[model samples]
Target: MNLKNLAAAALFAAGSALASLGVPHAAFAETTKLKVGYLPVGVYSYFWRAQDAGYFADENLEVELVPMAGGGQIIPALQSGALQFGISDALGVLNARKGGLPVTYVSFNFSQSSDNPVHAVLTTNPDIKSPKDLEGKAVATNLSYNTDWTMMREWLRKNDVDIDKVTFREIPFPDMLPALRNDTVAAVGAVEPFVTFGKEQGANVLGHYFTDVKSPVVLSGIVAMLPYVEENPDIVKGFVKAVNRAIEDFKADPAVARETIGAHTKIPATAIEAMNLGDWETEVPPSEMQFWVDAAEKEGILNETDDLNSLVWSPKE
Candidate 1:
């Protein structure tokens, strides 16, 4: 073959090899602009910290932060395929899964669930003391039978208070304080941003329940629709890796949390110190989901999760 023909033949073979190897052509591109939902609160430091520091950008992820009233409502959005990803309390994910909401947690966001570590039980009437004091009284939470209720049950058990003795109500964290002032509920179980706000309103801090039974409760964590996961598997992997990076960033310098205050949550820089944002490790310990299963089961909230194992998923290490 002449030099010109030989060169053309070599170029054709090279192009064919590249195409057969599944490598994208120069024109091929990844889907851009992800729609990620988050509750309007300060404890979601990892999500905010990640966005603030451009960790998502570094990973080639362009996340659109969509704010919702609370993580509980994120289920419907996820179910209808309106959201690509979001952070949700573990209970929300479990309950939604049972309800066939088509979502699951990809990583642990808040590692601990003591009522006080990142949240609080508030009572405006200082006369009330202990979980037993909640008897015959109404209480409010941003969501019912989810985080606060789970936390309340743990606190009640810890304080030797009967869970059946109290009347529980649902109120948004923003509305919880107002409900407390209006006598809608005697006390309100609240977490971050709201915890600080509730306390500032002269609401007495009754008790804090971080874990279900003094065990780590995986409160708010990241979950995604399985279809979305299957559609963009790399997005899921990149997102999780980026979260670990964000957590490391926050763990090393908590100052970034202050910057996230206005964007992710309404709380100020001064309040960030008081709230406990656990270590930013991406691991969702298999033991963590146990806290939710045990708590929800014992509290009579496990209507759909009779078998704990069925409701749990441990990502491969």
Candidate 2:
């Protein structure tokens, strides 16, 4: 089904579920309205789950989950006050901070670990057996300087592959598989659902790039402008609490998670069922932030370092 139809179905399902729970729509006398921007992907199922299950309502929040194309679009919207909050990769958030955007991560979202690797380097070429084999070949990522691209570059670098010799192409997640199939790109740095899709299409995984760098690294999280967070600390805390509740629900019920994911993302049920959903965390540790900080410095993405503590938002006692 198309994305629009799937989204409609998801909303209908959410409404039905909420109705069955006997939760009236006007239960709360005072509700904080929020516009949260996020990329439409399976990993972001927590947002949909939270909204659908009345977790946000339980926190007295009326959230409008805005589906965005990428961080590029989301970041600008957040800056222009079009969105109150946005979900972004750790790298993107750090980069934004370096560029002087007062955004801080309010809560962690998705994580990648060695045991449950959710991101992979997939290639259809028979001769490309390892990372080194792609030294002179082209690889596709959703975007340059994105989490996938940075992790893939680090993985290739650690594997003794000359990354300078490798050509990087920015193909959207949905287009990566076709790019690989047609040999438009030698390989693709793909995340879940797409990783499962690529394997189903006979593509071989060269490696789980993110895990290769470090097991259990924070990939992305929910971010908000510092000013908004400071002014509305209660709203930020409520958002984190609601999402944390949803994350717990997501972990406890895999079937419902898949259904919610399939309804929101364009991935088919078969691939969604097969894909590894990876890990979710409510807390974004300072060490995890430092890992990206060190990485950015090494990659010359950041010249001056910033305080890691300041990058994350916490409620004042």
Candidate 3:
């Protein structure tokens, strides 16, 4: 071989060696890293699926899914810039907004519909058969100001039970069953997986909350601080795309969703099989979100009417 040809071959070999060693090509760029927080519940089906499926990598994004106490409980972290994104309920997002925090819900992962309700008021005391019996009793909810809590409070009021008479306790979802079993709380607001597990633990199923709401109620969603979202609109869009794809993929095969749930939640296979899965939707429909806003205003959770359009980050194609 000629000297020039040998030199070319040697250069090619060096380049291939570098590429094999994961040295980025001249045009390659680092993936954007973002910290996302979730409640670590089985209901966060799509979030776990997206991570396991490499959807985030597909968008040149690296997501760090941090397990938080609860979605609503992580608002302060999100506001402090400690977290780039958080999964929260409509009530939490609105309450945060009303409290003067600039936050917005970006996408809906779970919603309460006629066919599928995400939360329920469960009681070990069969004597407290209905909401009317909740008066003077201690009821526990993971977040005092979240979607399920608001709906349960509203249900109590609408059922002729005075809200002030009921004692509201803040307890984590996992501890709710023990709280009820040990009589720490007379009734506990439980969501999927827990509700099924509570039943297994001999807790009486009172009723599913939001059963009578005429419109679909958003249960939980991806929330981000306004500044973070505004500064990274393209990143936010990519996130939504990955989440939406995950939702569709899960819908196409529900067993896969359940498996993802079990993997993240560590819930037993039997409980996961029996638990009712959430109605997962990616699009943020303004009309559906209005249900929570209206309820919040009427319940005095939000002092003023909220601008629905401003509170959601709907990405345009």
Candidate 4:
């Protein structure tokens, strides 16, 4: 199913109107307008909350959240300056920097918590009990050389499954169901809502892949060009401030999340209501980041010559 469907203003307005959703206000004397691209999925509830609660405005940021289909277009938009900032996975940012995109991750969007998993490996075949069972099988991933692919490889290797033996098929999240049903791919690496939806459709969940590899896995976050960040550190701070506030708003009330996610993704109310939303935070430790960078390097998604420091941006207190 297509995660993003154009929705009306009322859904967005719902967050701002809710009385229980409250966070400290950020004040800036000068307003800076920013155009940001986001996936418009439940994973990006913080972005919608930031917009819905006027946190961006409080931080003197007139933000425009451009709806993006996936990571494929987000970085390119940032590179060409079409977007001042965009949400993308760690591996995408690492590979982009390896390809000379000059981008750095500025904030954390979501990560794998013990209570909630952002991704899972699903199979229609019940015989495939473990990663090793799918030794020579074709697995579907949304992107051929992305964070999910890297994580899948690592998770497989840990299970003694030969990484070189498995064939990966690139399929969009929406088409994964059909692909699995038609036996196009033996298994699919699916993210939230889809994981739940896949289960609802009778697909056997192998396990939450991230948890199988490592706990507290950092999945994705906000990113922007390094040069832009250095030149306008305050803007970065303002944006991050808004994100932090949005995180609190989400934690404060469950209804705010339901409304914001429903507004942006247009996923069915039942799915949205039942979806396991992971932790939304602004801090991703360097050690946690090293795991993805190492995975990217091992997967050849990043060049050995690439420097890790340039690929990340941490705000100063």
List the global CA lDDT of all models.
0.70, 0.86, 0.80, 0.80
Clashing pairs in 2: none
Q: Give a tens-digit lDDT track for model 2, residues 1-317.
A: 99999998887777778878996644533788999999778788899999888999988998999999877788889999999988998788878888899888888668878888889999999999988899889998888876778888899999999999999999998899999878999999998888998898899999998998999888788888899889888888888999999888877877778888987877788888888989887766766788887787778888876787777777788
Candidate 2, superposed: residue stretches over 4 Å from native: 1-28
What TM-score does model 2 achieve against the real structure? 0.89
Per-residue alpha-carbon lDDT of candidate 3 for residues 1-317, written as tens digits (9 for 90 to 100) = 99999998887777778889986453244588988988777677688888899898888889998888765568998988888888887888788887889888878667667677667788989788888888888988887767767877876776888989999998988799989888898998888888888888888877776665443566678899888888889999988889889999877988988889878777889988888776788776766777787888777787775677878777666
- TM-scores, each model vs. reference: 0.80, 0.89, 0.86, 0.85
lDDT tens digits by residue: candidate 1, 256-290: 75566656555675666666655445665656677
Q: State each candidate's clash count.
A: 10, 0, 0, 1
Q: Write the per-residue lDDT of candidate 4 for residues 1-317, one digit (tens) a residue.
A: 23343343544455445534563223215678899998767888788888888888888899988989766799999888889999998878777767877878888557776678868899998788888888889998898777888778878888898978899889988889889999898999998889989989899888777778887777788899888899999999989988989887887886788888888776899998887888776666645668777787777666563554555677666
